[model samples]
Target: MNWRFNICFISFMFLFLLGLSNVFLGIYFCLNNIIYFLEWEIVTLNSMNIIMTLLFDWMSLIFMGFVLFISSMVILYSHNYMEGDVNLVRFILLVLMFVLSMMLLIISPNMISILLGWDGLGLISYLLVIYYQNFKSYSAGMLTVLSNRLGDVAFLLSIAWMLNYGSWNYVFFINFMGNTMESQIIAFLMIFAAMTKSAQIPFSSWLPAAMAAPTPVSALVHSSTLVTAGVYLMIRFNVLIMSTDLSKYLLLVGGMTMFMSGVGANFEYDLKKIIALSTLSQLGLMMSILSMGLPNLAFFHLLTHALFKALLFMCAGVIIHNMLDCQDIRYMGGLVHQLPLTASFFNTSNLALCGFPFLAGFYSKDLILEMCLVSNLNFVSFLFYFVSTGFTACYTARLIYYTMSGDLNMVSCSSVTDESWFMLKGMMGMLFMAVVGGSMLSWVLFPSPLMVCLPFELKTLALSVSVLGAAIGYSMAHTNYNDSLLSMHNILISFFLGSMWFMPYISTRGVYIYPMKIGTNLLKSFDQGWCEGMGGQGMYEALKNFSKTNQSYQNNFLKIYLTFFVLWIILMLLIF
Candidate 1:
């Protein structure tokens, strides 16, 4: 059997089939009263025990099934995307390892076991982000790893703190005894950890930078698995921390991230970066809703968003591949005529992301909006939610126009054919889900109807934003807004909004400058000067001087030594 047509494709189909079975099983278990719990004792010393506990509920099963489904699709897509790579086998193995880690994370109710999965995700993601072996990949890998390490440290500390409770199993204790101060601290640490993993707010720079990786990896990382892990963690811990100040903080951060990334997408030229930012925005939306005491809704959005977003990235991959590796949307237009199927997928996924009616994003996002309207939220939160919704529509419309609706901009000789059957097959597999995932998840997850009583104004906010955004996006793409660039005032305004309110600076340079200066001082004053002088160089000089003194004394003479010994003996005899 050919290597390209072997383990990778086989694993893809197998996992995909397994995922479908798990989904049915999850629905059955959810409808029934069966909750599967598995555990094994790994180590025990007196009262100190480390046990691996697995919790299989509707949530875990469904989530794991979705993860596997997406992973399998990504692997299938990689068959064509990663062709001719010398390390294709390694890439497939790494992807499988990532899927396994995600499964471990989903099933484990124990913090220690969760760490195994969590660290695996971080490590594998870093490796994947640097798979291209370029300087950009290396930098992105470092940033991604360092950002995720913040979460790792938080998890480790939380585990240490949980040891005081005599067990690492947080699922049980968090439900029963989580009202204590120590538990709150642990909850805070877990929130911090989740934020890093999910690319929330300040820890968000890594998500966009991680687009340096392969597109299949992007589809997997940005859509289904890595980014959603944080949201999943929050959903799991929602009961304990829902009403805490940390949850409120998450609401704030999540909302900000949503708005910032949405705005950033409008300005991004790189096709992949724009899509990546949109993913970030949706993640923010999920995090914000989860922070609002609705983890089920968040999880629902997670699954649905995974479906469409993965499709979106896969569509982007098709375009990029066809365009001879060029990822700039500015250079891409009138592609719909050439690549009809790919364009249809791209447009459908973008519309889904914008929460068009009946699409995968609409069910969850619409409910989230309605829920927010009915909830007792403040003005800022409401504004953030609605405005972010509008921004989402605006940027997605802009994206569609730039990539699918304009005149052809590339060289005339270039030919883009939708001939990659594997790519189309992978995308087609997801197209059905993208169309119906929202409704299916909505029906299954929320068996009872949501009682949302909103006023006319609140009820129509989403529709109004969608229309307005579409209009604005069409106008911007068709017209020439030279005043924004030529005028000093508009230039500053455009710069501010276009640069995502200087988030890149605030997250990178703003964070690095003071620490780097401090590090330089420490290197000069302590590491090289004081610490080295007093530790390594000073000790070496003192030891050398002492050895010289000992050598000189030994060389002085055996005769002198004998005379001193005789004198000492005489003095001893007189004393006696």
Candidate 2:
């Protein structure tokens, strides 16, 4: 309570004000179209000026505002969520450190200085992921850390590549040298890094695995902080990435990631994991759209998605908390009856996610989809985009069907209430943002609404897919319909989709199986057979025999001593 009263309360107040001011600054910066880049020379060696640089622009300020505002709400919510935990202070501290790292990253324009925040993020996120102090949390933390380390290596490589240009600040060189071979190489590396952090395909397994963290951290990580870092980086690097051939490949990866994660969520039963997969799906949408050379559109979607998704996670926390920590949707039917307020927030956030007309997700998500339709993408990319959009709606509807409208599945004695003041207050605030954040961001980020000219069919396609997906999702909630689905020949396809193309097997176990088998074989033939025999067991046997022989000799030490005494006397006389 003291920890809550002191650190949580103080941090919540400070961060809220900072976030509000950042929102204002962001709006002003956007209106004025001003970018202020400041550099501080740390040291000089030869011709290279080691410098730390900060970029103050609309994008960074707005992103900071959303990140900080969400983080503050999360911290305030945790006041009630983690009230009984003994390590509440430690949790709050980790969260504060996480926010600080995020701030450093948001402002940093130099690759070298950005690593401080990048590595800090990776380290602190690992600490937070393992915050529950259990084996599952540890294992998930390992996967999360190792996957992120690949991004670290990519960042390091890009940093080294940038060294050839005599400075670490990429902003100076990006616009002019964008089409050059060297810049393309750096863009490739940065794209790789962004993919891992943002949880695009082949690197998406960790997103679901990371659900092992507490809900509050999940709210921050999935919504506005950790997963979005990559998209932010790519947005910064868009000038360079779009000039090269890499954007095409990025488009394919993002589309597939979206389809993959969306299909996976419909198969998931764990409530939190389902939400996590949704986050992954939205991340793919952002990445795919950004890859199309629309960084501004991508940023718009990023901010709008953050608001609703954070509220979505908060509503989930309330449900899970009141249900005595049970996370399975199968155990949580008719929630709207028992916890109407939570259901209201949950359904609203979920609808916003589905891009329900003019809600937070609609303004941005609709624009992105519409922009995609207008672009000359290939049919495969086109299919992936729309199909993924449909699946997004499909999963959203399925979650609502399972949790909000069914018969009560909880125990009779269970007390489900949304009376937690702190948690409710946080949700209320995010709900407001989730409802209006889209229009606000769309207005600020754009001087006027983007006018996309499209045929009636094309313009309405997004809404159409959402409706069709919703119908399919609701049908999925019926057991009889599900059995019919399972009976179909598409069962294997469904299984593959549900298993994330078997990524847990491919990405997680697939990575270690070969090395593990090789290590096992090496242990038998090399360590156990040769090295152990010659180095350990062989030496032990040799030492044991020598000791035994010496012991036998020592048994006769008394007689040998007398013989030595006689021999000594005879030798002494001979020598004299």
Candidate 3:
């Protein structure tokens, strides 16, 4: 009867139903050779039309199962994490809404239904981010909404373009786009939209900002639903993106984003921000692989990343909750002794994240690098993958060092304890998957025939190089380099502090600067010269007198109207 109990009950029921639905659909799709199921019926003249179509293919089922699994974990974790929070009911409601929307997104066979679910997820995520209504959370929520809306605009445009060109369904678009120029354009626009939704490149700032949300929201957004949506979009349009010039562009953008965000992750101090940046970087890697026409590889990485990143974030949450909400890694060190399980889980997840040998991240990330080597864009792709791997190792190592192995002198253990059994169980389950999923995936997803015929030699060499790079990075982090001089006044530090004010000017100089300067001068003139010339406070009085003088003329339009009407009548009579 209590609010929290009610939320728990509802959440459990929803996930249970969703899991059951996925199972039924999967069985139906596989056993009955059913290509499509129409749940809603309609009529057009004498013809019967379907209103809702469900296409349950392998890809949709895989992603749907993942969504359901992760949603269930989040719900269980929230039961403990949000125990005493006043908005627990609202939080659970939003979680259910998000899960339902994601399920709908994966199952929807038409663009209209897909967009409906997509927008619903976005809206609910925004609301969840600002659930507490604090200033910072409000800003985060606004940023999330604004970024997603920009992506939604691209989606709408693409849909309209598709409709105008006579392709209203996913299957038709896939077939049509494979043989047309407009298809490439639409594909490019869709990728652009996906990038924004997944927080890739220029739009990536919003994901880090979204850390203002509760930890459960972070897990949902980063691990399972929101960020993965872009990957899904890429997968949905896999045939189109692969067969067009858009593929080349996707490869380039995705590769660059992977490398760039990897570098950014190295510079972050907040625990959540580090993980958030890593998520973006991993998304980039997945996108790059997808662009290379390897949707299966991308999906594999998506699954692995979800498992480890969720584990890492939840572990970090346990630490934060124990430390009275402190998130800065600078203030956290040597928590292993007090929170052994949290530390262990964090380490395991971080190992998987760094692409260590035989871990989930290793298989997925190595496959991505291998695909890069074999892709047509191999030269550029290899370089991006190499650089990104190095940077990923650096930041991931940094996170581990800062959190678990650092000097404990600065950290206080005033009220620290291990996480609840439920949280620990959830994390351990993910950790188990992170450790073993890679091998299972390598067997299931990688084609054995292709693996044998292709140059396994090159892939082996690539994997060796990636592993070696990670090792070098791990060793570098292990050795404490005493470079106080370098640390005291690094150029990057100076640039970062000063750039806050100067970068805007530099960036705006081309077109923005001129307009901004002109506007500023005009404002100055209005304040200093115009106001003075108009006698400051007496300007209103002068305006009032002028308005009074004009009022009679403005109001008394009867004479002018009559004269014009009479002239018009005379002219008409003369013409007749």
Candidate 2 clashing pairs? none
Please give the range of 10 consecutive residues that has the lowest summed lDDT in model 3: 497-506
Q: Which regions of candidate 2 deviate over 4 angstroms? A: 41-50, 479-491, 520-576
lDDT of each: 0.86, 0.89, 0.76
Candidate 2, residue 481: the lDDT equals: 36
List TM-scores for all candidates, in order. Answer: 0.91, 0.90, 0.82
Tens digits of per-residue lDDT, candidate 2, 1-576, equal 664568888989999999999999989999998999887888999997767789999999989998999999999999999998888888999999998998898999888778988899899999998988999999899889989999999999999998889778778878887578898889999999999999888999988888888999999999888899999999999989988999999998998889888888998889999999999989989988988999999999889988999999999999999889999897778898888888999999999999999899999989988888889988999998899989999989889988887686876568888789999998988999999999888777887768999999999999999999999888876753336655245788778878899987786677766778889999999989999889999999999999998887788788878887999999999999
Using lDDT as the measure, what is the rank order of every candidate, best first? 2, 1, 3
Which TM-score value belongs to model 3?
A: 0.82
Ranking by TM-score: 1, 2, 3
Worst 10 residues of 2 by lDDT: 479-488
**Residue pairs with backbone overlap in model 3:** none
Model 1's alpha-carbon lDDT is 0.86
lDDT of 1 by residue, 271-293 (tens): 99888888889989998998889
What's the lDDT for residue 261 in model 2? 88
Each prediction's RMSD over C-alphas, in Å, is: 5.3, 5.0, 8.3
